[model samples]
Target: MGASLLPFQVVDYFKPGIFPLMFLTGPLLYLYVGSLTIEDFQLKPIHLLHLIPFMLVAIHRSTIQVVPISSSPDLVENPQYLFNKVYYTLLIISAFSYWFLGLQLIIKHRKKMPLYFSNYTGKNSLNWLIFVLSLFLIVFLASFFSFFVNNILGLAPVSYTTLPLNLTVFTFIMVYFGINQSAIYSREKVHSKLRHQQLSPEESLPKSGGALLSDEQIAALSALVKNYLTDKKPYRNPDYNLQMMADDLAISRHKLSHVINSGQKKNFYKFINQFRVEEAKAMLADPSFNHYSVLGIATECGFNAKTSFNRIFKEETGLTPTEFKQTLERSTN
Candidate 1:
């Protein structure tokens, strides 16, 4: 809609009645630029450094319009030509950023492989990185060549005229593929961390392997936690702390912490909330609870607010309450 309404023609971009529409680009620019800046904080220095030129190009596009000189036979004015030249230059620079980062990632990953199976690098990180780098290069070439051919022949006066600047189809496709590749690498990183998690392998044994608790002790602690969840008791009591659970379990705070951390593989608060989330999930799936809002279900589960409840629920089940309920309905149907 916006592309048709605001064509690549410089006159249409800055039309008499279109100033308001053009002005609306300010907030939109702020959104993209602000998000990119925030992302720079989380990204590696090399990745963020590469993205700087792209950010600058986005800013320039957001600010300036390259109008053609009508009276000149060549349709070249000094200022307009300079703007077009700089615009394409910035775009090419930004493409180089992606190319460099992609190559660096590939090289770094390749160096990490074992020499014996280096031939299998094709099945590992190198293959994934190369595929992503190739995809981005294709997008970069397509956009740059498309813009170059259109502008050099005067088919499109503005640098953005050949390709829809606001839409950034190539950038979007490149980012989508990059993120997919990153996700695979990030999961590998997580699994690698998890593999070497414990300092003492002996202590990593399951509670079931040894009598960490007498049957009586286990039953008492389980009953207390179960009742607290079933009763929907608020955790807001000023004195409600780990000490309270320890006292109830008739164990020292240190021992109880070990039991929760080592046995259950979670902190006391998280262990407790896992039970609450289970309660909430049952309620959400029950047809009887269908009339209740999400907030009501969250409160019934002893959560302080719907926000926290929904976040944790999604983390646990990979689905929101609404999504889970929809799945339940679909399965039953």
Candidate 2:
């Protein structure tokens, strides 16, 4: 009885231009379901929050049609009022979830790049945030807010007002798609950056020599490297070479070179590369870092070129960067 009594306009609601697009929503289910399934296998959140829109769209369309019909010929007496309430509550929950997810993604990326920030201070960051926020607002806010405002405060409801509700939903869809496109673009950028880091030699090299370090020297060198890597301030005006490193360590160049050569059993290039490679390795260990390419990792690690990174990595670790990555993945899995 309930199925028959359900407003028949459900089918008519999707007409002509809108029907095809509405039909595509089914396939979109694949994307969300597939991603969630993979996340499950990895012991990650299923992110059902993102999938709520599909359910909400169905609810919105049905409610829009049924509420009017319930007043007319097809009046099923005492039709569950709680049905719409439940659907609306779910929509609100999903909207909040998406907002938090969006903010989390932006925050994570900003921390990765010193130049990247989340606040409104910089034009770029502000613009990006605004664009993203606009997407959410258009997609999930306006229509819902309008509904509440009309019901509570005598403001006009989008569903009944001059505004076309479908148009609002379409605008939201476009904004959502834009966010997806931007995410893809950002992923590519991070990939390139990681590849560049992998090839940089200075990142891989140790301060002097040996795998082990004295507590005091380790503390100082760690601080120096951390500051250097994080701040990225200018290199000094001098040679900017081994002599500089030796001077920084407050040791003679000969002693520094000897320690690097004999103790670490590596030349300057290889030693520096060790630091770079290790750092790259740490970054790669993170699932979020998967967007970065091997080439980007090389450059970020202080390798001047792909060729050098590969050669030195193989010589020092007895495995190529790709091989190392594969090995790491396998072990972790």
Candidate 3:
């Protein structure tokens, strides 16, 4: 999409072959996000259907003779111009549809992460990917509006074109995202085992006691989780997640999630953070750890970052880590 203006904006490198690629922007964005968020994502025959539009347009363009775009293009009389007008309109509709679906995937991903990860970093939460998707959506909207108003409806003079500007913005956004994506993903090897999420269920536990599992089973698993978390202190690992605990407990993710959500009435994230906060409070009151700063204490207490530790600490204690520490000091005085 960023390079779609090459034919019109650059006469010397004029090749509108990328014109058909507008049809692909939505699918590509949707799929790219899906791959990152969906644990079991894979290419299937049904997904190939998305490529048909691009293929048909590419094939059609091969047989047609497109007029050269000069300093000012007036291809209104050309069949290619009419065809492009129609497809670009479809592109707007198709792209928006896919963008909305892709946005939903991201939304689902955001909601799902807390169910697993204790602290959300760039790699674990895919925030950078979501940021890139937002920019792409914005740039596409601007580019479509510019093309529709200026070229299709002829509402403005040739000098009043935003296509070049939009294309340039989109290009830079893609390049920047591409460069950083590798580094972010590389920081933590995205183990597919960890992303073993069933987005369909969102892994929500049954609302009632008599919903799915037997009471005896829930009770047994609840005991197991309490013992594992308290005795072993797995929550101390900031990178801890649902799958890791599940694997350790020799249970399914669903069963472990049910034990935490249904039996204990806490989501995995809160259940774990509660432990960390308690550990922080214990350390804050202990003179043995006075040499440690608040952030240092947060690290010892299993929080990966200070900001999150501070936020969650306050959420639990009604005071920041530093404030809580000062309260302890004053109480002793």
Better by TM-score, candidate 3 or 1 = 3
Ordered from best to worst TM-score, the candidate numbers read 3, 2, 1
Alpha carbon deviation, residue 121, candidate 1 (Å): 9.1
Clashing pairs in 1: none
Output candidate 2 Cα RMSD: 18.5
lDDT top scorer? 3
Q: What is the lDDT of candidate 1?
A: 0.50
The weakest ten consecutive residues by lDDT in model 2 span: 185-194
Q: Which stretches in model 2 have alpha-carbon errors above 4 Å?
A: 1-8, 12-81, 115-126, 138-142, 149-333
CA deviation > 4 Å runs, candidate 3 = 1-16, 68-80, 159-172, 175-211
User: Against the correct fold, how does model 1 do in TM-score?
Assistant: 0.34
Candidate 1, number of clashes: 0
Candidate 1, residue 79: lDDT: 46
Query: Residue-wise lDDT of candidate 2 within 1-333, one digit each (tens)?
Result: 222245564345442212223223323333432332221222235644444456555555554533431122211442542344444445455555555655555555344322121111222233445464565556546655665455333344233532234335545654564455322112111211112232223333454465544444445444544454344411211112453454344444445555455554555544555566666667667778788887777655655557766776787679888888899899988
Of the two candidates 1 and 3, the one with more favorable lDDT, higher being better, is: 3
- Residue 176 Cα positional deviation in candidate 3, in Å, after optimal superposition: 4.2
**Deviation in angstroms for 192 in model 2?**
9.8
